[model samples]
Target: MADPVHKKTEPNGRYLIALSVAALGVVFGDIGTSPLYAVREAFGEHYGLALTEANVLGVLSLIFWSLIVVISLKYLTLVMRADNHGEGGIMALTALVMPSKLRRGHWRYLAVMLGLFGASLLYGDGMITPAISVLSAVEGLEVAAPRLEPFVIPVTVGILLALFLFQSRGTQRVGGLFGPVTLVWFSAIALLGLAQIVRNPYVLTALNPYHAVHFFTANGATGFWVLGSVFLVVTGGEALYADMGHFGRTPIRLTWFFVVLPALLLNYFGQGALLLANPAAVENPFYLMVPGWATYPMIALATAATIIASQAVISGSFSLTRQAMRLGFLPRMTVVQTSSQEIGQVYIPTINWILMFATVGLVLGFRSSSRLAAAYGVGVTTDMVFTTLLFAVVAWSLWKWPRWAVVLLTLGLLGVDLSFWAANIVKVPQGGWFPLVVGAVMLVVMTTWHQGRALLSSVLQKDAFPLERFLETLAASKNPPVRVPGTAVYLTRNADVVPPALLSNLRYNRAVHENVIVVSVETEEIPRVLGSLRAEVRALDLGFTRVVLHYGFMEHPNVPVALYDITELDLDPDDTYFVLGREIVLPEGKLGMPRWREQLFAVLQRNALPATAFFDLPPAQTFEVGHLVRL
Candidate 1:
C-alpha cells in the first residue's frame, strides 16, 4: 500500500477559522443557549416554587456566580493545564492521573471503569443536548406567536431532522457564517441586557456575592431547590475540556473570559431585571427582554443559536466514539473523514442514526423545552462532579501541587459540585432516570469489553512463545544464508517478545530473513514521547533484531514517519517492507465473566472496527496471520 492514512496538511489559517467557528457554533453554544431556558427552569417548574423578584434576583446571582466558579475558574483557568499531550477531555484527564496504562489486571480494570463512567456521562449528555437545545429554541416560536403553541414539539422535530441531514455535508460550508453570526448573536445578548440593566440599575446588585449567600441561607426550603437551577448555568461547561484540542488552551480561555462570560452575565442580569419589572411574564422572560419590535427577531436568533448548540453535541459524540475505539474501551467504528483538512471533521453513521432516533424520541416525549429541561441538568451536573474529583487527583498527585492548596481548592470546588449533584439526585424519579439508564448501559458495555480482553491474555499465555527462544532460533539459522538484505518486519502487538507470526514465517519459508524487525505498539499514559527516543533498534546476528515503536496516547502511530527517521533503515521509506499481525477474538468455552455481560461485549465489538484500521495504516503493506488460543 502506497499510503492512505498519511495525510498532508492544508493551509493553517483556514483550518483554524473553521475549527474556531465550529467550536463557537455547535461546541460552545450549549452554555450560551442557557440564557433561553436556565432562568425559567430554576424558578417556575422543576425545583424552585415561586418566580418572585427576590427569587429571580437570587437565581440570576447564583447562575452568574456558578459560571464564575465552574466554567471561568475551575475548567477554563485550571483543568485545561492538566491536558495530557495536548489532548483534553475526561478520558485524557483520567489517563493523566489514574495510571490507566501502567497498571494492569484489576487496577487497570477500575481506572477504565471510572473513565468509562465519565465518558458514558458525556454520551448521555449528547443524547439530551439536541433535544433540549432544539426544544428550547422552538419554544421561542410560541413566545413570538402564541397560536404556534400547539405545534412546538413537531416543529422542533423537523428542525432536528434537518440538522442531522446536514451532517453528511460537513460544517465547512455553513461554519464560516457561524463566527460572524455568533459575534452578532453575542452582541445582541449584551445590548439587550444593557437596556434592561439601565432601567433597573439595582439588578446589578445580583453581581454581589451577598445576594447569592442571602438567597440560599435566608430563603427557607426554596433555597435548596436552586441546585437544579444552578445546573442550567453550568450546562455546556464540559465542552471546554472536550474541545481543548480544537483550539489550544489559550484561545478557549480567551473566548470564555473575554467574550462568552461577559455576554452571558449581562444577559442573565437583564433577564432578572425584566422579571423584576413584570413577574407575570416570567414564562418567556428571555424573549420579553426585548421591545415588541425586537421580540420576533430575538426569537429567530435564539432559534439559530440553539441549533448550533445541538450541532456541537452531535459532533462531540462522534469524536468521543473514535477516541474510545482507539483506547480499546469501545469497538472499532467505521469513521468517514468529511473534510480534507480538518481532523475533527468526522462522521460516524451508526452514532448519527442512533442519536437522531433518540433525539426524536426525546423531543416528542418531552413535548416542550420546559419538559425536557427537567431532564437536562442531572447529566451535565453529574459529569461536572466526576471531572471535579478527577481534577483533585491531578492537582495533588499528577501536577504535584502543594497539598494544602490542592486540599482547599478540592474541598471548595467539590462542595459546590456535590451540592449541585445532590439536588439533581432528587430528580432521579423524575426525568433523571433517562441519563441514569444511558449511563448504566454504557458502563456495562465498556466494563465487559475490558474484562473479556483480559481473559484473552490469560487464555493465550500458553500459545505465546518467549522472546529469547525466537531470537536464538533466528541466530541458529544464520549458519547457511539469510534471504533478503533490507528489513522485513513483523507488526507484533507485544514488544516484550517475538511474535508467533515471525516464528511461523521462518518455519514456512525455511529461510532466515535479513533485518527482521519485531515492532510493538506501546502506549504511554502521559501521551506523546519525545522524538529523541523514536526506536530502540538493536543489531542482532543475521539481521534479526528488536525495534520497539513507542507512541504517547497524545500522538498517532505514523509508521512511515517513524521508519523514515530510523538511521539504521538508511532513512528509506520504500526499502522497508511492513507486516501486521491479526488475532481472532473469540470467547472461551468457559464463561470468563458472566454470560449476559459477555453478550454485551459481543455487541460492542460488533460495532467496533479492527485495531489495524484505527491506526491509519495502509492495508496492502500489512499481512494478517490468524492464531487461535484455547482456555
Candidate 2:
C-alpha cells in the first residue's frame, strides 16, 4: 500500500484558529469532560476513601504528572511521530512499523488481530464516554438547584439526543468555538481553583513527589481505591496520539502542553484546596468552588464540556471505523457524505445510528455519571495493557531496543494498567457490564467476519478459475462485444484468481463477449499501493477478456476514476457494466465454521453494508451475483 501522503493545508489566519479550535472541540471532548466526575468520584465515599488535603493534592499531582508523561512525552512526542502516511492511530502505527518491503502474510494477520482488539475496546470506550460525561455534568444540577434531582436522567437524555442529532450535520457551524471556548472553560476551572488555592497553599504539597509517595506508602489499601477514579484523569490521553492525524501532531501537542494541561492541573489542585478547607464539601468540591450566584453558569459550562467530551469520542469512533474498514477488520459501511465541500466530513450511517442508540440506552440505563464510572475504566485500561504489549514488541522486535529496557518498561506499564483493570472488575455487576458485553459481542462479530473473510479468500483461491484454463474453455465464442449485451466484472475474495461469478456468468450467457473483467481488492499491510505496485492485467482470447487491477485503499475508489487508468478494458464508461456476487450459504458442506455459530457469522456478514459504497466505487454499474452454496 502507498504511504498516506500528507499535504499541509495552508489556511488563512482565521482558518488556522478554526483548525486549532475545531481540533480542541472535536478532539479534546473526551479529556476536557473528564473533570466533571474525576475529582468527585475519586473523593466519593463509596468509590474511594475520605478526602484529605494530602489525598487531594497527591491525586491531583499524580493526574497532572500522568498527563505530562503519558500524553506529552510518550505519545505526542514519540508515537505520533511514527504516523503512517498522514494517519495516526494504532492501526496506522501498525502499518508504519511494517517492514516496508516484506510480504510476511502471517505477521499481517497477527497485526490485524491486535488491531481488532484495540479497535473493539474503543467501541466499548465510546459507549462509556458519553454516558459518564453527560451524567456527571447533569448531576451538577443538584449543587446548583437541588430541585432538579429527579430530572437529571431526562435532562441527560435530552442532552445526549441533541448531541447525536447534531452529528448527522458535521461540526461546521460551532466548530470554531471549541478551542477558545474550552480555553475559557479551563480558565474558569483555574480561577475557581485560585479561590481555594489561597486558603490552603499547603495543598500544593501534592506537587512534591514525597507527598504522593507518602500517601501510597502510608495508606496502601486506601490509595489503591483512589486508583479507580484517578484513572479517569488520563482517560482521554490516548486520543491525543490517535487523533494527532486529524489535527497535526504539532497543534494537538501544543494545545495539550500549552493550554489543556496547565488549566487541568491548576483546577485539580484548586479542587484539592477546596476539599482541604471544607472536607464535608469534598463530596462536591467542583461545584462548591463557584460562588452561589455563579452556580447556574457553572452547570451550563459543565453541560458544554460534556458535549465536547461526547463529540471527541463520537469523532474518534468515526475515525476508528474508517481505519477498520480500510484494514478489512470491519465490513464496508455506508459512508454518508456529510459535507459537500469538505471531503473528510463523513458520517457512517450504521455506526452513527447504532452508537446513538447505544449511548441513549447507556444514559438511561446507568442514569448517573457516578454509576457509569464503574463501566468506563475497564475498557480503557484493557486497551492500555494491549498497547503496552505492542509497545514492548515494538521496542524489542521492531526498534531492537535493549532487552532489559523493554522488560522494565513493559513491567512498569503492565503494573499500572493491571491495577486499574482489577479495580474495574469490582464494577462488573454495576453498569460496567455494558461495555464489556458490547466489546465481547463486537469481538465475536469482528473475529467472525475476519475469520470468514479469510476462509472465503482461501476457498476462492482453491475454487478460483484459472485465467489460462478459463480462456481456453470459452475462446471458441465470437468477439460479439454486444452479444452478451453488458459487461460482467466479478469481484474476487482472492486476488490470485477470477471469481466464481465470472465463470458462472460465462456459463449462463454463453453468447459471450463484451468483456469479462475479474476484479480483486487487496488490503496491503502498508498504507496504499502505488501505481507500480498495483494489480496486473493478463489478456486472453484476443483481448476479449481482460483482468483489471485496483491499486489501493486510501485513495478514494471511484470505478469511473480507476477505470480511466485501466488500459485492459478499451471500452466506454457508460458501456461498462458492473456485477456483484451475493453468496447465500447453507450448512451442508461449505466451509469451516462451527455448526452452531455458522448462522450467526453468516448473518453478520450479510447484514454488513455492500462493498461498493465502502470502496467509494461507482453505483450505476454495479449488480450482485447470488449463489446459495449448500455447505
Q: Per-residue alpha-carbon lDDT of model 1 for 1-631, expressed as tens digits?
A: 1111222232246665555554576547888888888777777654546767667778877888889888889888888877766778988886765563333466544555666788887888888888988788777777778898888888888988998888888887776677667767888998888888899989887878877787887776668776786788888888889888767766677667777888988888988888888886688778878788887787778778878777788889888776665565666666878877776778888889988888899988877777777687787777887787777676776577898998899889889888888877777776888887888888777667767766765555557776767667645754644476665667776766667776667667665456677777665554456676656776665566677776654445666667668877663455666666555545454645776776665555555665556655556666666665433
Cα lDDT computed for each candidate against the true fold: 0.73, 0.70
Candidate 2: tens digits of C-alpha lDDT, residues 433-466: 7776787777777777767777766655666667
List the RMSD of every prediction in angstroms. 4.8, 3.3
Total clashing residue pairs per candidate? 5, 16
Each prediction's TM-score versus the true structure = 0.87, 0.90
